[model samples]
Target: MYETKTIKEKIKLFFIIFFPILITQVSLNLMTFFDTVMSGQAGAIDLAGVAIGSSLWVPVFTGINGILLAITPIISQLLGARSYDSLAKKVQQAIYLSMILAIIIIILGGLFINPILNMMNLESEVRFISKYYLISLGLGIIPLFIFNTLRCFMDALGQTRVSMIIILIALPINIILNYLFIFGKFGFPELGGIGAGIATSLTYWLTSILAILIIHKMKPFKEYQVFSAWVKPKTKHWKEQLKIGIPIGFAIFFETSIFAAITLLMSEYNTNTIAAHQAAMSFSSLLYMIPLSVGMALTITVGYEVGAKRLNDAKAYGYIGISGGIFIALLNGMILFLFNDYVASLYNSDPDVIALTVQFISFAIVYQLADAFGAPIQGALRGYKDVNMTLIIALVSYWGIGLPTGWLLANFTSLEPFGYWVGIIVGLSTGAGALLVRLRYVQKKYDKQQNPSVD
Candidate 1:
């Protein structure tokens, strides 16, 4: 039944599948935004506390998220080839691999949360708040990892709607939980920032439960050998997943670590500045969902085409995805540019916060085109299972150029936060240029190997 799609139907299916995933991604971010807004309303200290704690946790989760990126591509390729038996074992393997990684991340997150808080030299209130927030949040990291596996499994099987639906269902529950805990509404103890963390932890597990139910009920992945093989985990299958996923883990970790590191630096400043930075970044981040989700779709499409031995179709999808991202970036940048102050003000009512938000977000908007342009390039590379250069690119763009440049701009120069953002643009642009060139070169080389001659 899945094999009956026409070319046009396939493209439409791609977009339809992708659009909901985009919304799911955006909704996930909204969960964070609401959590932040709730904390901010409690107090400036609460806002900054959660922000700092989040900075420490974000890199870890992002790296894990990256590590899991190999899933949809591998599964989709196998699914496309109708290799159901291999697909079943691989699914089990992904879960096993995720479980192992999740444990390490959870321990690391729990162990370091307090130390990182202390290192920030935050106000006594801010430090305590951060510690409380991180403790509860850390417990949910493992569930978050498990949820990641479910999400990819659903998407690869063309059940993207399952993840989307689960996330959507979880959001309202999260909001109600946050409201009850943070404000002590409905007979619950008022927990404030800590309440936000608890609410987040609950929602993480809740969403995973929802995904698990959906995956089980669906025909596509209902027979997954791994899901049924809950008795004894297959060590060989686990290694197979790690073989594909470990590089992804490193790539994601390296990339997210850069942003997290930057946020850590931002936390060292005044609380007001950190709050403002989060507000600015929060808005810029929401807009990124479009290209990022599109990139995800590109991965699935390319993987399927290659597995099906339709390389020309893979190349076509690559072009489509990259062009699509450029258009999205241009449109998103224009809107952000036009409504800088308006968007900034939406997050916080403070005039000072709003004003600073506009400045930073404006600078960020400048390089968004270049930033978005890189999504498909990296997506295509991941599609081809060619991430060996990911570490090099990440190091050069994020650490080698991005972090140092941002520091000089923020500290030594007059640009301050504005310069810090300019550095992000430069890094993204540089990475995009190099990755795109690499994609082109690889595609040509692969085509030549298959064709033997251009003529």
Candidate 2:
């Protein structure tokens, strides 16, 4: 149903899909940004508490969300193949899987939250805030998972604007909720950082409800009968989704957890250090949405072409997405380089925090460059279902190489906190190189398969 024969057309198609996803991603991250800024206003302790809780929560959320993301490529491929009958069933199974994972996470958090925080030797107030923040946040995990599953389905169908609109509607509500709860306005208790978690959870429920309504009431989506004809969960369908999803989950887990781990490790330093680290990390994450959006767009586009058996078109989309990510990264780098000090001041006004945040952001400029290179290629590989190798690469690069290098430097060298940034840069560069090679190999293999006589 969808075809792009020329590079120009492909680029146009890519951006059409890309821009909405970009808005969705940016809007989503802005929720987190507001949470940090609002909580920081409550006090530095509140900011650090939210940071620690997020460090524990984000990796887990992203990893599981990554698993659900498998639905995008799967559904996109099915769409490209024009096998419309099975889409509803696939989405139903993904929802079931998401529910199961959400319960598991909630249970695990209940069991581990106290022990993990206690083990950290954190300040009393910080630990108290972290514990409750996670607990409050856990309430929304199910709805959040469900929302993400639906989002992946919509994205695969090239209805990305739907997601963008939903998030935009929710973003303001989340900020308002954060304000009322954090500052104890309108008779709301002054919950500080914990309020952010509650706001986020409430927002997740709203988004999930909206997604369900849209799918049921909308024309093209309702045609899929995602709700009208409910399908029973089948172990076979779950396995099929998990097989592709597990590797993706671990790959993303490994990557995101490295940042989480760095946050936890920084907890050993003074509160100022922790807050500064989080501010820089948070802004860097905002910048990262650009490349991440491109990568996700590639997953849909490349997956569609691959499903249609248009391997050359898939390859072209991959190249375009990767190049576009790099170019955008260059622009981001310039802006960050020029405005690092100003950006740092936006997060907090403590002169020490601002100075340290500037240093951390300098390192982020390099970090973004590597991410721009690697993330899109990884997305392309997902299109090909080349995920197991990516899992291996992520594990080796982030945990095996990046963490160790950072740990050694942080403890044994003068780089201290900055050492972790160096390690991240190195690790990302390595992963990017490995992923690029993997993409080329897959491209050639598909090429050879299509034309057996090729040398």
Candidate 3:
């Protein structure tokens, strides 16, 4: 009985899903941007500390929670298939899995992060502040994952506005808290870079708690009956979730971890070097949220089509999403390339930092092109329930090709951080090329399977 939508209608629907997710992503990255700016105001050392701390934990955060992210695609497909009866149970299983992951993160990452910092050979002051920053941020790991689980659930159902609004509300609070705690305002102890950690942690708890309350009370969520029953952790659910999620997690880890490793390597240079890297990386990351949101939308759209047994429609959505991503990426890259210096100045007033930032942003601009192609295709693949291949491809691209090239160039040549940036470009291009080819193969294969009489 459902009427088919025209291409224009589909595109509009994509943006409706995309913009809220984009807002949420922009808000999330802005939190980090604000943190870096606040710490930079404190001093070069503070900025470096926060940067290094971020470099260490961002990967861990992404990798661990990345698994839970699979819930979005899984649920989206189920919804498309009209398999409403099991939605609540599946959501419960994801929450239970998230809790287990959180505990492990706290025990391993929180308790034993110091040894890893020690091995990095950071300056004593930088090491001291980074340690506390990571630990303070670690305190909110549970709430963070809980928030992610719920957000993914809502987003898959095309209800992204709530999370966007919640994060928007939290952003200013985090900035205010950063100012108060970092500068010893309102009789609070001045914690500098560590203050950013506390501020972000508090924001995480607040947002997660709000999400839970809203989900429980919202009229829309009432149909899902997420809270109607308590289902104990089941082995089959655990295995299935893990089977889908672990590859997704590692894929994220491979991409993020290489960048983290580069940051660690840059520590040998100086605080100024690390500060500049943070500025450029943060800005680039902000731009990346565009394609990322587009890709996420693709995952939902494609998965829904696949589940609804609309294979041809899924192929069309995949191509439409990829084309949109590339166009936006090129636009973003041009802007960054054109205004790199002006943008860098906004992060810090330090001349050396700004100069370095300009250079790094140039590469970031180029990097966006590859990111555009790769990110959306990966999202499309997720919709197809094809993730293990992504993991394999990521490993080959990032570790096999990217890291070794960066290490050799940075250590033995004059490129330094630039060398690492070059590696990123190479790795992203490799992955993008391979993914696009793979997606074409998948689409054709699926089409063939769906229509045996097709030429």
Candidate 4:
């Protein structure tokens, strides 16, 4: 599906895959957005409970599921190489791995939920709500992991629209369920924030079931016979995927945890300052989906070319994807700069919060610019299965440099909360530079291997 010969065709193909992935990303984010909004309607306490629960859940979920993300590049390369014989088994093994990971999360989550909550000086009701919310969310972990694994499979096969359609179908169901459970509609109990958690869990199961049904009936995927013959778990396959996946999982963990860390650090500030920071973060995260989708699309295209032994084609895809991402970032920056006030107003009516939010968003323009550069390059590197270096880069950039710098500035200097954002921007820029250098080196290494006579 990714055999584009010209730049125009490559761009066309990239975007076709990209737009659907973008929609999927946005839809997923909207689910979380709606979760918070609906819970807020229940009461401020309910909203706070859900927010606290999510702050812990989001990083863990993304990090663990990131291991399953390896499935995309692996499957894409198999398709490009036309290595069909082993595809189903590889997928099957990934399913097993996901199941194992999901169970571990459920167990660990149950054990640690109370102790973690205890450490935080939360009100009794909020603590109760937070504990139950996480427990309710835990019910869906298995299916969620399975759904993510299937999503990787679909994305790898160039059927991003299928996943997009599935999420679109599920999004409304989630909202409706949230309404029913949160407000006790249709004789349901008024469980408030806990209801949102239940709604999300149900939504996850629905999505996973839909994915299974689609693969069962779908044409190209049906031909693969992924579910027909379940293979026993093989340690070798687990190792192979883990070798590529562990670094990816930790890299994503480090990146996401940095944001969580920033949120925690912001707790010391006044309510207006904290709220403003969150508002800006919410909007900025929405904008991030654009470049993140582009990066994901690049992973598919680049992996396909590399698997096909078309090193030059892969290099071209990396260039086109990164450059296109940056151009889009420029547009995003302009939007943020031009409409900062208007955007801030959407989040709050208080003039203090609005003013602070606008300022925080100004910092986000630089953050987005740097992310536009870094995120896609990381995706491209994954295409080459060059993940270990990305993990190392993430560690040094985010924790070693980013968080420390933010801490120093926020604590010791006048930048205050804004200092954390500056730290994020610097870390992202540094990572982007490192990723660019690494991408160049990997491309050259592949090119040299392909044509040994070259200097």
Candidate 1 accuracy as TM-score: 0.94
RMSD of 4: 1.9
Off by over 4 Å in 1: 1-10, 223-226, 229-231
Clashing pairs in 3: none
In candidate 1, position 81 carries an lDDT of 78
lDDT of 2: 0.92
lDDT of 1 by residue, 302-392 (tens): 8777767677888887887888888888899889989897887776778888787788787768766776887777777777777777657
lDDT of 2 by residue, 1-455 (tens): 27988888899889999999999999989988888888888888999999898888888988998899999999999999999999999999999999999999999999999998988858999999988888988899999999999999999999899999999999999999999999999999989999998998899999999999999999779999998678888999999889999999999999999999888887789999999999999999998999889989999999999999999899899999999999999999999999999998887878999999999999999999999999999899999988999999999988999989999999999999999989899889889999998899999998899899977
Clash tally, candidates in order: 1, 0, 0, 0
Look at candidate 2 and give me any clashing residue pairs: none
Q: Which stretch of 10 consecutive residues in model 2 shows the poorest summed lDDT?
A: 1-10
Deviation (Å) of 137 in candidate 3: 0.8
Provide the RMSD of all predictions against the true structure, rounded to 1 decimal: 2.0, 0.9, 1.5, 1.9
Candidate 1: which pairs clash? 67-249
lDDT of each: 0.77, 0.92, 0.87, 0.88
Worst 10 residues of 4 by lDDT: 266-275
Task: List model 3 lDDT by residue over 96-144, tens digit each.
Answer: 9998899998899856788889988688999988999888898888999
| Candidate 4 lDDT score at position 79 | 93
State the weakest 10-residue window (summed lDDT) of model 1: 1-10
Q: What is the lDDT ranking, best to worst?
A: 2, 4, 3, 1
